[model samples]
Target: MRPATDLAAGRPAAPAPGPDLPLDGLLRRAAAVAPDRVAIRTPLGDTSYADLDAEVDTAAGALTAAVGRTGAVVGVVASLDVPFVVAYYGAVRAGHPVAVVNPLMGDDALVHALGTAEVAAVVAPPRVAERLELLRPRLPKLGGVITAERLPTGLLPPGERGPAADLDAVACIQFTSGTTGAPKAVRLTHRNLVANAAQIAAVHGLDGDSVTVNHLPLYHPMHLNSAVYAAATQVLCPDSAPTAAVTAANRHRATHLYSLPVRLAALAADPGLGELRLDTVRAVLSGGSALLPAQARALSDQFGVPVVQGYGLAETSPLTHCERPADPRPGSVGRPVPGTDCRVVDVAGRFALPTGERGEIQVRGPQLMAGYLHEDGPATDPDGWFSTGDIGYQEADGHLFLVDRLKDVFKHENWLVSPTEIEQVLIRHPAVLDCAVADHPDPSAGAVAHAFVVLAPDAGPLDGPNGPAAFVNGRLPYYQHIRHLDVVDRIPRSPNGKILRRTLREAAAAAPTDRPPGDPT
Candidate 1:
């Protein structure tokens, strides 16, 4: 058996000091240290570190041979499966910068992502492969489409090239959905990904002995890279059912459970939750969106485990801060992880603000992305601070609180309004199942709050405007009040549970505004 150092092909002969290794380099070190230990556990089967490493080598070699060289951009249709993880690292090891495409994206959005990243090839599931096959003629630069289940099988020759990664090399391009325009690709370097993975491991207390149960609809690189970097075992839970999480955790004695806010909220509201016991679970981590304070509390009290939340964007390797298990906060996203600096800036994106002052949150860290793909947008300043378009504030103790998105905040007369704040207040109503708040343009006031709400099951219809509208109006200030209420069957949300405020705002602009029932102005 060769030492891990011997595997280094294009880089220095000796391993670099600290956790500066490229993304795939972390896998090599894990395989070398714990060859026979299990690295991934899926419903289909379990894969050991040694076998996983060998398979990655085979996949990388095959991809390189098919593409004819390194640095070929590949689009990976991310799914909640082991193959997604394998292909992601394999492509990186083969020196291809992968574009993590959301399989559920609409046709137009998918085309935009594939074209922007200039992907030479696409790897997708059987169903998605068929869709890509139909659109192959549209993508002129697309070399081919490979099914995730059928990743070419062949080992590289003894003299074939191996992972030749540099710190500045682009590892992956993450497409972030913008509120105003099409989704933009976030270009992250090997250094950014590797550093963020290490930071996640440190803050999450992930180690070789830790086992994580992932209950997400798609395979997120943040979870994959961080778990691999820590040499921790990952159990993939494909089902969204809340009870499925308990079964998987207890079956594997999992230490951590990772999921999105939507699923966590459902889990907290599950009627049969009290029947299940999660003795091995230590923490429930939520990301992608803010977890409702009530939902977090309900789950924590029911399961005897801390239900925590974290904050970050695609440009920051997807994880900058996470709540510590020992000191969990219900509403706050906790402080920044090691090596990350966070501060609030004024709305103009300049002049640092005082503590508790709401403004745009900017982060500077080794984990920040190199830049955005295709678009000539300024992702970071000369000082390396990336303005997260999100409106938030940091406490004197450093805990971060997210308010709203910069584009979503609107001016209502003399006051700036956050739709998120009104949405949170409305969801507290027992009859409201889900709701979204958007700015409704007005002639008198610059804008007024409009709410699109989904009522709870079997809930009776309320009087025209006096029901939820009056209920919410009575609780909020004049400028913050929801002037118009639209009853809808459902609220539009992105796949990851973020409210599509832009969609609602557009609808509000086109629809006629109804006068309040009581007509009190």
Candidate 2:
């Protein structure tokens, strides 16, 4: 095979992967590398590469028949089993845009997306089918609703025989948070996802020997591009992907696990680790939510695997900065992966700044999402550097340290504040359990710091308002300290456990504060 540089330099003898290189090609390459190896292991059973290939062919035939046209949107709302992968590849095989919808989303959000994106055919499991049925009256353009359990006994469309793909053809559509307003669909082309996969794979040394142990929900970016697409050997998709994760590792002899911090905390706290015979997976990757730096160090020593952090967002095809296993910076997302150029910039999107300066993060690479579905948004700049809306800075050594989400930062007595920094310090408190810090609007200052915390069971009767407020007030600078607080059973979280600060923000906007009329507090 010619070197990638050969293609980059436009040499006459160099071979371009070409616009025709499709998602199926990735599966085909995997087949070449390990034709008969075990590829997907679920609670039901294990599927080898040869079996997976056959399933792809059969499912493709079924998917082609179901869609039967060029301008069709295929939806997959099944559980995270091999069939979902089979159906996804099958849609790509049928040459149609596939939208991977969340099985957990409510009927209203689901209906809004379907209406806005104009889905033609939807394929879903029984549970998802129930929700889709609720919206059936509202969706006028919906051509067909098919269940994952059953395939139609009919012929595929003749037009389903896909010709060469245009690199810009929309392949997948993922949605952003609708909290600010209505959710927007992110358009990703075949080349967009494929190129991002190549960059992620190249940077991590992902190859035929890499066994990815996945438990993350399949809809997330880290789960898709970082774990599934970048994996070289196989992805073990458990029935209860999270609860079954440790078991799958032992069963499949997995070499890597890309998990969120909640999972990592559970694994670290597992009583089975010291007594039970466990699999010898080589690396444990933690991201999507904050992974406590202390947890990284402790898990490394206990489990005998280094836990590394990675960073990215959905718009950038998920991965841009990844930690290298050979030499790691545990708290930092190691560096920009090959083929990706990342930098920190001011809100105006000017020139790149020096390392260690907090600013909005931007990335330019082959893997960026094509654009927001048809609305033409400002997600990416003319230079191809997409604004991640995340705040962080690159270290002098090239490692990236994530500060916080841009939206998560708020004004605290005229100084810009990041909740992550305060939360980091707050978590270190003995009585404090899960902590979330946000800005509560104040009369004198635009907003003041507010905290909600969970206390450890052992800590007696001190989890309420004054308990955490007093602790933070003494430890932090005057402006940085939280002035008001509430005790909650737990922090509101996403299905994945990323802190739901927006929910807290919304509640703050509704509540009345007790502070004096002109006080910043």
Best by lDDT: 1
Q: Give the per-residue lDDT digits (tens) of candidate 1, residues 1-521.
A: 11111111112212211387888889989999988889999989999888787778888877777777678898899998878877888899889999999998888888889998999988899999999988888889998898988886445566565656888989999988655568888999989898888888888999999999999999999999998898999999998887898899999999999998999888888988788788899999999998999899988988898998999989899888779999987689997887787877778637677777788888888888888876575778876778888898877667889999999999998898999999888888767899999998888899998888888886654544546667788788989887777889888888999888889999989877567522322
Candidate 2 is scored at a TM of 0.88
Which residue pairs collide in model 1, if any? Answer: none
Alpha-carbon lDDT of model 1: 0.84
Say which candidate scores most in TM-score: 1
Lowest-sum lDDT 10-residue window in model 1 = 1-10
Give the clashing pairs for model 2. 65-156
For residues 125-184, what per-residue lDDT tens digits would candidate 2 score against the true structure?
A: 877887788789999887778887675323344444454656678877777655435678
TM-score of each: 0.94, 0.88
